[model samples]
Target: MEVMEIIKDAFVFPSKDMKTLLIYVLLSLVAAGFSFFGTVVYVLGFVNPECFMWGGMAVIISLLIGWVMYGYLISVIKSGIEQSDEVPGFEWWENFITGFNNFIVTIVYFVIPAFITVIVGYMTNVYGNAMIVAQEIYLQATYSYMGSSSAIAFDAIYQALVNLLFSLTITITVAVVVFVIFSFLQTMAEARLANTGSLSEALNVFEAAKDIRRIGIGKVIILVLLVIIIVAVIEMIFSALFSIIPILSILSIIIAPYLAFFAQRAVGLLYSDIA
Candidate 1:
C-alpha cells in the first residue's frame, strides 16, 4: 500500500484490536519495571552513599528484566499481526524470536542510524557552542568599555545568556537527532513487519516512515498534551496533600514515579501501532 493509504488503513483500525495493544503495553511495562527500579535506587543513593552498591545491583537487574520484557513484546506483536483473523496471540517464546530479530535488526537498522545521529549531534553541538562563545565575546567586548560599575552586571548577564543559549541549542539539537532516529526506526519497523528485507526494500520504507510521522504525529499529540497536563495536576494535588497529610504524602512520593512510567508506557503503545 502507498504511505497515505497505509496510514488511512491504520487509523481506520484505530486500535480496535485492544487485546493486542494491551498485551503490547503490558510487555512494555514489564520491561520498564527494571529501569524504574534502577532509577529509584540510584536516586536514593544521593541520601546514602553506601546505597550506591544497591543502585548498581538495580541497574543490572533492570537490564536483565528489560531484555526479557522486550523479547516478549516482540513475540506478542509479531504473533498478533500474523494471526490477525483470530483473537490476539500472546506467547512467552515470542520474546526470544523478537530478540533474535532484534539481534539482526540491531546491525541492520540501529548501528548505522545511531552512528550517523551521533555524528550529526556532535556537529550541531560544536556549531551551537561556537555561536554561544562568539556571542559571549561580542558582549564582553562591548561591555568592557562601559565602566567598571556595569562590567559585573554585563558579565553576569553575558554568562546567563550564554548558558541559556547553550542549553537551548543542546535541547534542539538533541531533539532533531532523536526525531530523525525515530523516523528511521519507524520506517524500518514497518518494513520489517511488512517483510521488506532487501536493502532496496528497506530504503523504500523510509518514504513511508517520513509520511507516517507527517500524518500521524497529530493523532497522538493530544494524548501527550493530556498526559503532561494530567501529571502536572496530579503532582500539584499531591503536593497540597503533603501539607495536610503526612502519611499519604510519603505514599504519593513512592507512587509518582510509577505513575510517570505507566503514562510513558501507555503513550509508547499508542505510537507502536503506527511504528
Candidate 2:
C-alpha cells in the first residue's frame, strides 16, 4: 500500500472492531493512570522526604504496567499488519511477555545513544558549572575593584558564556540526531518483533537496517513526520473541544491510546509493504 492509503487505513482501523478498541482504551487508561500517579508520587517525594518509599513502589508498579501495555499494543499492531480484517483481543500473560521482550530490545538499542547523551550532558554540566563559577568570581571582582579590574572580569564572563553556549549547542544537536536515529530503528524493531514474534528477529539490527534501506530512509522520515503532524492536529482539535467542558476533559485520556493505535496501525501498514 502507498503511504497515503496506510494513513487513511489508520483512522478507520480501530472502528472495524469497536469492542476490541474499547477494551484497549480501557486498559490503556488504567495503565496511564498508574504511570501518571507514579510520576506525581515520585515528584512529591523530592518535595517531601516522607513520600519516598511509597513513591518508589509506585514508580516500579507503574513502569511494569506501562511495559505490559506497550507489549499488548505492539501485538495489536502485529495482528493488524498480518490480518487486516482482524483485531487482536486482550491476552494478559501473552501481552506482558511480548511487552517485556520489546522492553529489552529497546534498552539494548538505546544503550549507545544513551551513553552518548550522558557524555554530552556531562560536558554541558561541566561548562555550565564553569560559567556559574566565573560569573560569581566576576561579580566579586567587580565589587572589590570598583571598576579597576572591570575589563578582565568582562572578558572572563564573555569567555565562560561562549564556552557554555558552544557546549549547549553541541549537546542539543547530538541529542536530536540520536533521538531521530533511535526512533527510526525502534519502529522497525517493533514491527519486526510483532510480525515474527521472535525476540532474536527483532534484535537483528543488520536485517532491520536492510529493511529500512528498502523502505528508503527518506521515505521513512517523511512518513514519520506526516504521522506526527496528523496526530498533533487531531490532538489540538480534541483538546479544543474538550476544553469547553471541564468534566468532559477527563475523556482526553482516551486520546493517547487512540492516537497510539492510529500511529501503530499506520506503521504496521507501512511495514506490511516491505515485510
Candidate 3:
C-alpha cells in the first residue's frame, strides 16, 4: 500500500467503528480520572500531609492504566500489520507484560539521545536553568496551595544563563532530529516485536534495518515525515483551539490516545510489506 493511503487508512481506522472508539476513549478517561485524583491529593497533601499516601496510590493506579492501554495499542498495530479489520481484544497479563517489554525496548532506543542531552545539559549548565524553572514552579504551586508567597531564590542566577539559551535550543533540536532518525528503526523493531511476540526482535536493530531495506528507505522516511508533520500540525491546531475555548481542552485529552492508535496503525502498515 502507498504511504499516503496507509496514513489515511490509519487515521480513519479508529473512527471506523464508533463503539470501539468510545471504548478506547472511556479507557483514556479512566486513566485521566485517576491521574487527576492523584494531582488533587498531592496538592491537598500540602495542607494535610497524610493525604500523600492516597496520592501515591492514585499515581500507581494511573500508571497501571497507562501500561494496559499501551498493551492494547500493540494489539492495534498487530491487527494493522495483518491487514485485519478486527479490533484486538485485551488479554490482561499478556497486555501488561508486552507493554512492559515495549517500554524497555523504547528506553533502549532513547539511550543515545538521552545521553547526549545529559552531556549537553552538564556542559551548558542547562540543568541549573531547569532546576531554577522547577523551583519557580514549585514556589507558585506553594503560593497557590498555602496562600503564602514562597521565596524565589534563583531568578537572578538563572538570568545569567540566558547566554546558554542558544546552546539549549541547539541541544533540543539535535536531540529531536536524532530521535526521529532512530524512530525509523524503533518503529520497524516494534512492528516486528508485535508480529513475532518476542522482545528479542525489537532489540535486533540490525534486523530492523534489514526490514527497512525491504520496505524501501525512501518510503519509510516519507512515512516518518508524514507522521511527524501531521502530529506537529495537529498539536499546533489543538494548542490554539484549546487556548480559545479552555473548557473544551478536555477534548484534546480524549483525542490523545486515539492519535496513538493512528500512529501505531501507520507503523504496522508501513511495515506491512514485510510483515
Candidate 4:
C-alpha cells in the first residue's frame, strides 16, 4: 500500500465499525482521563509537597490504566493489520496481560537511554547546585574584594550554564534518536505480536530490526513524521476549539483514542503491506 492510501484508510476504516470504535473510544477516555488526572496530581504535588501521597496514588492508577489502554489499542491495530472483519472490544484480562507485556517491551527497549538520561540529569543538578553554592561562597568571601572577583563570579556562572545546556542538549538528542529507533521496532513488533499472538516474537529485537529494514527504514521514518505532523495539527485545532469552552475539553478523552487508533492502524496497514 502506498503511504497516502494507508493514511486515508486510517481515517476511513474506523467508520466501517463505528460501534466497536465507539466502545474503544469509551475505554480510551477512561484511560486518558485518569492519566491526565494523575499528571495534574503530580504537578500539584510538585507545587505543594503536601499533595505527594495523593499524587502517588493517582500516578499508580493512571499507569495501570495507561498500560491496559496501550495493550487494547495494539489489539485494535492488529485487527486492522490482519484485515479482520470484527472490531476488538474490551477483553479485560487479555488486554491487561498484553498491555503489561507491551510495557515490559518498551521499558526494556528504552532502559539504556533512560539510564543515560537519569545520570545526565542527576549530574547536571549536582553540578548546577554546586555552582550556586560556590558562587554564594565566592560572593561572601570576596565582599571586600568585589571589584577584582566580579569577573570570576561571572565566568563561573557562565561556565555552569554552558555545561548545563550542553548536557541537556546531548541528553535530549540521544533520547530523540533512541525514541525513533525503538518506536519503529515497537510498531513492527506489536504488529507481529498482534498477528501471530507471540510475545516472544514481539520482543525479538533482531527480528524487529530486520522487519524495519525490509519495510524500508526511510519510508517508516517518513510515515512516522507524517503521522506526528497530522496528529499535532489535529491536537492544535482541538485545543484551540475546545479551550473556548472548558467543559467541551472533556470530549478530547473520547477523540484522542480515535486519533491514536488511526495512527496505529496506519502503521499496521503499512506493516501488513511490507510483511
lDDT (Cα atoms) of all candidates against the true structure: 0.52, 0.79, 0.81, 0.76
Estimate the TM-score for candidate 2. Answer: 0.83
Tens-place lDDT digits, model 1, residues 1-275: 23333233333232445555555555555556756777788888899986778877877766555554444444333332342333234455644455445445545555555665567556656555656667666667776667444666666656756766766576567667766656446433533433332334434446546544754655545444555666688788988888888778755533453343334333334434544
TM-score for all models, in order of appearance: 0.44, 0.83, 0.74, 0.75
Candidate 3 C-alpha RMSD relative to the actual structure: 8.2
Query: Using TM-score as the measure, which candidate wins?
Result: 2
Q: Sort the candidates on TM-score, descending order.
A: 2, 4, 3, 1
Q: Candidate 2 clashing pairs?
A: none
Clashes of each: 2, 0, 0, 0
Residue 247's lDDT within candidate 3 is: 90
Question: How does residue 191 of candidate 4 score in lDDT?
Answer: 81
State which candidate, 2 or 4, has the greater lDDT: 2
Deviating ranges (above 4 Å) for candidate 4: 29-65, 118-148, 244-250
What value of lDDT does candidate 3 attain over all alpha carbons? Answer: 0.81
lDDT of 2 by residue, 184-212 (tens): 88889899999998999988877888878
For model 4, the run of ten residues with the poorest summed lDDT: 140-149
Q: Which model scores highest in lDDT? A: 3
Model 3: runs farther than 4 Å from truth? 119-174, 234-254
Relative to the true structure, candidate 4 reaches a TM of: 0.75
